[model samples]
Target: MAILSALRLTRAPGAAFVVMGLYWGVFAAHVPVFRDRLGVDDALFGTLLLGSSLGLLSTMWLAPKFDQGLGRAALPTAAALLALAWIAPSLAVAPMAFALGMVGVGMASGLLDVVMNARVSQIEARSGRSLMNANHGLFSLAYGLAALASGVTREAGLPMIAVFGGVGLLALGLMPLLSRAPAPAVAPEEGGAVRLPLWPVMLCGIVVMIAFLSEATVESWSALHIERTLGGGAAQGALGPALLGVTMTLGRFGGQGLAERLSETAVIRVAALVSATGAAIAATAPGPMVAYLGFAVTGLGISVIGPMGLALAGRMVAPHQRSQAIARVAVIAFCAFLIAPVLMGGLSEAFGLRAAFGAVAVLLLMILPPVLALRRRAAAPLAVPA
Candidate 1:
């Protein structure tokens, strides 16, 4: 029964990841339209991404509380369903209305992330193995397929809204499946009640945030950097994101095997070093091809960090206390992700895209120590012989 439950819960996150990919696959081309619809400049547009993060943070805070009465299914359902449900408002021609719609979408996504991830932790506990990386990899793959779909659509000059809205509508099909899945968590937990060592998890949170920020920065800004700094054409520029996504998916797919062969601590340390170097190289690459190579290298280096870190966090603490701990770490990670797009956009606007990626490279370097600590924390306390 737990195995079946794990499979069902696992499917929810993978499906959600793929659907988000589908939406963006065709919708990114509408960036200018979304900008125009929001009545904002590039900087503000970047800042606006915060709405989603904020929505995510807020929902993370509330999901556990809501789950108290609504049961485990509550958070994921809220998270999964609303991302697509509010599209009607998002499609409105007005900027304020569109922004409002984005807020709804962001909040829904954030709530869903909190719930789904919490469920992921639960699923891992029940299954007694590592499944986080593969699940997240599916998310990355969905993101790639979505972006590729968008590129093909753009070449046809289709209405971006039509493509996105169609994708949004298709998300409706997922709701029924999600509704049938068993609730993994019963309630939002009080940080006050958690007995886990906050310092260790807190440290893990910082590293996770840095990794997330690196990923978010590349996801949001790599293509722009390639185009503006490396002189890529429209197609090349567009391909930059797809390249990053594909590389990341491939890296993550391979990460599980690598994790089995090494300690998570050692893997994280090496991966962080490689990622930081890749970021630097990408920032300075003389042309697009080099930049793409840099992006792929960075992807491979960082791919394992996310899943390994999250799994360590889950195993480090007691089962009853895991959700709040995970949430604490997740909130910190979301803050980094939330800030990434805005920060990159502002840096790009003020200096150039190259400078922005250089900043991400620097942040990626900071993750190594904490990841090592998290790994040590997860290892068994050696039993002394009587």
Candidate 2:
């Protein structure tokens, strides 16, 4: 019920999340095709994918400005732009063109991601509700559905353009839902940028970054792992991400209540361990069914980490700096998207997807140190310099 209430309260931002989920879901399910189209190996495909980070990195400063300048329209505007930008990758036939297309995708995705998360923080502060998990749950739900559908279409031999273009149209149609103005909150200063807390933000950002890297691992490579490594068909490969989406939805929706009962750090600590175990299982799995079980476990554990990190960062800052703090953490964490393609690509190319996933298991453990640091500072007053 709280999840439903939170989703209702943050409908506009939730819609933005859903749109992102749909686009990414479709993209994730179709990675093999995209790579095949360019006729490149995993290593080069990963490098080319890194180009999107250039676009994402550029938004670190621009996102805060967009929040201040556009006010309520910021999230929807970014979503609309993303609708147009996501179509480019389907059109790209060469490695160079694909790389450039990813830049466009990254730019649009970065802008929307920052604005929507910041908006959710703004609403949470005003409504005094734990909304992040619920909103993210909505995204996961949409992502699963989209991935399932994309798999069906791919198996039917549908054109990439038709699939991506249809997703864009769906995103465009959701613009009205995402267009609502924000709940009243302290607006950032119009003329100058506010300084965000460096150390605390970085600590939380790293946790989020690791979580996202693990997430990107599955999103970008899980299908290939299932189909190639486990000898699954196209539909079975799609189920890899689809299962993650489903479990994440359950985990995040459940997290709304879990956050109320437990400390955010505690939840994240246990979550990290759980997710690590799941990744390990996935890495060692010999069959698609075993892999599915591993992925399901990973999704449930990882679902709450990023949301909790952002929620913690928001709590640590002043109201006016919430957007900036979210933006900064997002900038740092989103670098995982950049790192994932190359890291996972190289690992899978050399050692295989199993080793690459094993590395994800190791990476999940890295969240524990930051969890300890955040707990130590939990009682400290907000002490960041202006």
- Note each model's CA RMSD in angstroms: 4.2, 2.4
The candidate scoring highest on TM-score is: 2
Q: Write the per-residue lDDT of candidate 2 for residues 266-301, one digit (tens) a residue.
A: 999999999999999999999999999999999999
lDDT of 1: 0.68
Model 1 segments more than 4 A misplaced: 1-9, 24-41, 65-80, 83-99, 185-194, 318-320, 372-386
Give the candidate number with the greatest lDDT: 2
Taking all chains together, the TM-score of candidate 2 against the true structure is 0.92
Q: For every model shown, what is its TM-score relative to the native structure?
A: 0.84, 0.92
TM-score of 1: 0.84
lDDT of 1 by residue, 25-49 (tens): 4444345445656676557667766
Candidates' C-alpha lDDT: 0.68, 0.87
Cα deviation at 166, candidate 1, in Å, is: 2.5
Prediction 2 global C-alpha lDDT: 0.87
